[model samples]
Target: MVDPLLLQLAAAGAAIVGFGWLALAMDVHWEQAQGQRPQPAPVVRLLRVLGSLALAASLGLCLTADHASMAVLVWFMLLAAAVLTVAMTLSWRPQWLRCLWP
Candidate 1:
């Protein structure tokens, strides 16, 4: 069986990566991270799909790591943290997000 703590950490990482991908899918955020380049439609769609899958993976990891109620609550909290981390990274230093897409 997978270690619960490891799974929790993986869940958090996945949530962050998921949010980063989703943010980069947006025109404004994409421009911030990868300036002057034309945003490709196909890449945008691919990023959106990958981001959604990562989020679902995070939820799955969370559920596997804990009881149902706790897992839901923990996952919600993880989402909040992930959103803040991505937003701050975007505003403070969006170039850092390039790693997510590239």
Candidate 2:
């Protein structure tokens, strides 16, 4: 089995990167998908898929490190961390996370 600390850290990193990929997919920066820089649809699709896969991997890592009950707890904790990452990014970097529209 993998070390619990490693699993936990991996889970947290995966969650954050997953959220970042998702945010990029939606072009939350506005500058990424608009007139001066129109991102390709395939790239956006890939980002979305990667985001999901990363989140899934986080759960897999947690499950590998512990029993089912502990795995479930870790999974939910990672989920909460992921949500917090998104919220904090939106709150702290509103300029970087501007809507696609005006």
> Candidate 2 lDDT, tens digit per residue, 1-102?
567899888988887777766777775543442435676888788878988998888888888878989998988988888878776776577444434222
Model 2 TM:
0.77
Candidate 2 ranges beyond 4 A from true positions: 29-36, 94-102
TM-score, each model? 0.97, 0.77
Model 2 scores what on Cα lDDT? 0.73
Which segments of model 1 are wrong by more than 4 Å? none
Model 1 weakest 10-residue run by lDDT: 93-102
The alpha-carbon deviation from the true structure for residue 69 of candidate 1, after best TM-score superposition, in angstroms, is 0.8
- In candidate 1, the residue pairs with backbone N, CA or C atoms under 3 Å apart (3 or more residues apart, or in different chains) clash, namely none
lDDT of model 2 at position 83: 73
Q: Who wins the lDDT comparison?
A: 1
User: Compared with the true structure, what per-residue lDDT tens digits does model 1 show for residues 1-102?
Assistant: 989999999999999999999999999999999998888999999999999999999999999999999999999999999999999999999999989877
Q: Residue 54 CA error for candidate 2 (Å)? A: 0.1
